[model samples]
Target: MRKRATAKEVADAAGVSKWTVIRAFTPGASITEESKRRVLEAAAVLNYTPNLLARSLATNLTHQVAVFVDDFANPQKLPFLETLTERLQAEGLVAVLININNHFDHVHALLNADQRQVDAVILFGTAFRNETLSDRQLGRGMPPMFVLARDSQIDGVPAVVCDAELALRDIVDHLYERGYRRPGFMTGAPALSTALRRRQHFIDFWKGKGVDEIAILSADRYSAEAGAGSVRHYLNDIDPAARVDVLMCENDILALGAMDEIRGNFGLRIPDDIAVVGFDNYELGGASCYGLTTYEQPRIEMVQAVIGMIKGRLEPETVTLPGKLVVRTST
Candidate 1:
């Protein structure tokens, strides 16, 4: 086996004291530029890289974050994962992903995070209960957490989310101005809190505007197949006489599915007979064929907010960013 090169050996080769060599490797340590240069050159020649684990023990900071996400199949989540990991890498923080699909899985992931000594945790969904992450449950030295795209408040857990109510208001305003009175919502599974929040906000916003009645249909999941089925049910079973003038979907994928069904199955013209709108302005929304009118979440801004909390630059509190309404041909 090859002998490992130590800081002492680097110091001897660089003609500097061991203290100077340690200072040269430490961030923000007071060391002369000449000494640092010599120390780095000797380290390179000796093939000696500082052991991050040993340094973490000394500084009490691993600079590693554990990210937990459930909806890996969701297209929108793919971009979110990419952007988050890239940003963490740019900031010199290591990111470890824990793909959990349920509450029990989240608890296990939390335990794994603690075992790995991660500096922070970022959760991507709202499925995990707040109490499961409390200090009493997690013990005294639990990592600070940031929940992304979750609207509900989890005690002591900060969240970075988009304004669901604001997005719904924007859609309603656009549809109303375009002479759409009988508006309906096509959303995800009944068990999903995100779907419930979006549906309730739309209903409340319209009700507050003195609109007495609004229709809502639930899909089995947030997928194209479920969206198409919901639209079929809404048109055939719920509003068989084609009473709805506009359909607002909870996600872009849902909207696309509804659009396909409307044109292919129902033979209804889009934005002519009935307009369609969606949220999460996924990249496919910009395609000429779809051109879906929707609200775009400020994902970059939300990520920055979460990073700020991790770095102690921002308070650990829920931050809701306003979504931008992208008007397209679909509406």
Candidate 2:
């Protein structure tokens, strides 16, 4: 096997010090253009690359951000993850995806991230709760933490999330204008505390308009099957004449599933029989099959805010960005 070339060899070939070679490879590091060009040329010739482990040791920063996720079943998470990883890479940072599951919890994920010396930790899923953030043991020696796509009530922990109040207001106004008098909401499991905020916002916005009586339905989990089941049960239990005219779901996945259940099983025509609206404009929501009217979260802007916070370009405070309402045939 051939031995890898070292930075010292590249430095010698470039007629510069080893520190100059390091600066040439480091992002945003001060280095003369000529020196950087020589270092790159020498590095290409010798097949030399700076050791990230060594660099982390010297700088005390790994340039790695730990992102904790658990809700892989939801399709909306895929787009958010793609946007987040791409943005992190663009900022010269790496993302360490940690799965929070039945066996491993948020506290355990926090410990692992801290042990790995990650520059920051991002809670990107519903698995993390405010109680977990308040854990004293997990707080010690922990890296800077932020919440993405969800609101954080814990002080000192900033969050980048969609403006739920504005989204819900827009949704309610649209529904009211469309003559949707009786409104209903479909949510995920009880464990999803973050989703409760959206549900409450939906109810509050409706009540503000004097529509006091709103129906609520909850799924067993954050999946299409759970959503379908919840809709099935609600339809079976409610009288046809008193049923809700419009259903607002916590997410696109639930709305998609509810639509399928409503049409496929009950033979109900969308908008003619019942209108549906959802949050998070997933790709399939735009498809002709579903044509789901949903709210589009400002995913790119939210991810950029997170990167800005990491780079100190923005303050580490709760940053709420407004999203747009997407109208489709479903509504």
Highest TM-score: which candidate?
2
By TM-score, how accurate is candidate 1?
0.91
**Residue 223 accuracy (lDDT) in model 2:** 80
The superposed Cα distance between candidate 1 and the true structure at residue 105, in angstroms, equals: 1.1
Task: Report clash pairs, candidate 2.
Answer: none
Model 1, residue pairs in steric clash: none
The superposed Cα distance between candidate 1 and the true structure at residue 53, in angstroms, equals 1.7
- Off by more than 4 A, model 1: 1-4, 102-104, 134-137, 189-196
How well does candidate 2 score on lDDT at residue 149?
91
Which is the leading candidate under lDDT? 2
lDDT for predicted candidate 2 compared with the true structure: 0.89
Residue 190 of model 1, lDDT score:
47
